[model samples]
Target: MSLQFDIDAVLDRLATDGWVVIPHAMPAALTAELRDACLQVWQQGLFHEAATGRGDGQARRAEIRSDSVLWLDKVATLPAVAAYNAAMDDIMQAVNRGLYLGLAELESHFAVYPEGAFYKKHLDRFRDDDARTLTTVFYLNEAWPQDAGGEIRLYLDADCTQHIDVTPEAGTLVLFLSDRFWHEVLPATQQRLSVTGWYRRRGGSVPW
Candidate 1:
């Protein structure tokens, strides 16, 4: 099916469920470009396992290298990425109403989790940083399955008790309020690739 870019419908669902999936929001060709970019970065030996040096960081068995602003500089400037970002901007505007300004940073992340690699439950946004309002994730795998195991589980409450599980499907775009939700990337029985990032409101920067 062709991707549908329904900003209002998606925003409405996000407000209610704390998360929404815009299936195939990305074009097949763009998805291929992103996948190729991620693979190229991997070949350059720039990938590394995500290490937080804390007990809470043990779930992810894959590697992660940041500095996406640089990686996306080349990709985002491409006609395909520019068009996608424009669509995302429209969605952001619909959510924030007339207060939408501009993106603080566009992070390009490549996640490669082999079988058993997973990210434990965590929130993308910190309580101290309110500038980060929206988090977006794009799947790169072509034909992900329901049992693929690399799904994102998003908490639906403040207590992190109730939750919803989202399968990682190619060309799928998932977005939600960054700070208001807690989520995790489950272990995959096979290799998984994706580009995940956030759109922030104008604000002072936070130390990572």
Candidate 2:
């Protein structure tokens, strides 16, 4: 059974730790469905090599990141994508109500990190614009072995002195402040499947 969403617990963690990981945040059946969708889309050749930066300033640099991505549209008719976005709507409402974050919109995409793929440590907010206020990564890989690595490292400071490494287990949700934390995906021995997204504030360039 899917566990109920715990808004208070999530909010408390965000306030104190600046990040949180919720196990079983999503239903197993939904995750399986989404995983199938990801594979299907990938087979359809819809995913692209992910790029960095924002707006006109973006470019692909393999050294910085090496994941393939397929962005999800809120209005998409795809059942998996549309259902996921609808669930996020309630969460966003709760976040804005509890924290007054002024988040105006959200964007999400399927990210597939092949074996040996990794992303260099960086904040989610663009340097030229502070529109992205929060970030979320939802894992859809079942039986993710700890030894398979692909763990996400969240640095506690600007210099990476203290940090936490999290396994990308199926149904796991990682949430953090976009500009306040520096994080990265470590090279994985196995493929990693996830949906990464951001909540943006007003006046931010639409995160298409």
lDDT of 2 by residue, 1-208 (tens): 2244788989999988889899888777888888888888988989999999866778999999999998887226788877777777777888899888998888889999999999999989876777899899999999998799999999998788999999999999899999899999999998899999999887766433
RMSD of 2: 2.1
Reference-based TM-score of each model: 0.77, 0.94
Q: lDDT for every model?
A: 0.69, 0.87
Per-residue C-alpha lDDT of model 1 across residues 1-208, encoded as one tens digit per residue: 2236766777678766767888888778888877777777677776766653333443433343222222354555555556666666666666677334354555545666656777777777654555566788888888887777888888889998898887888888888878788888877888788777777777635543
lDDT score at residue 94, model 1, on the 0-100 scale: 66
Q: When superposed on Cα atoms, how far off is each prediction in RMSD? A: 4.9, 2.1
Model 2: per-residue Cα lDDT at residue 94 = 82
Q: Which ten residues in a row have the lowest lDDT in candidate 2?
A: 1-10
Q: How far off is model 1, as Cα RMSD?
A: 4.9
State, as a TM-score between 0 and 1, how close model 1 is to the true structure: 0.77
Among all candidates shown, the one with the greatest lDDT? 2
Q: What residue pairs clash in candidate 1, if any at all?
A: 48-63, 49-63
Candidate 2's displacement at residue 98, Å, is: 0.4
- Give candidate 2 regions above 4 Å deviation: 1-3, 205-208
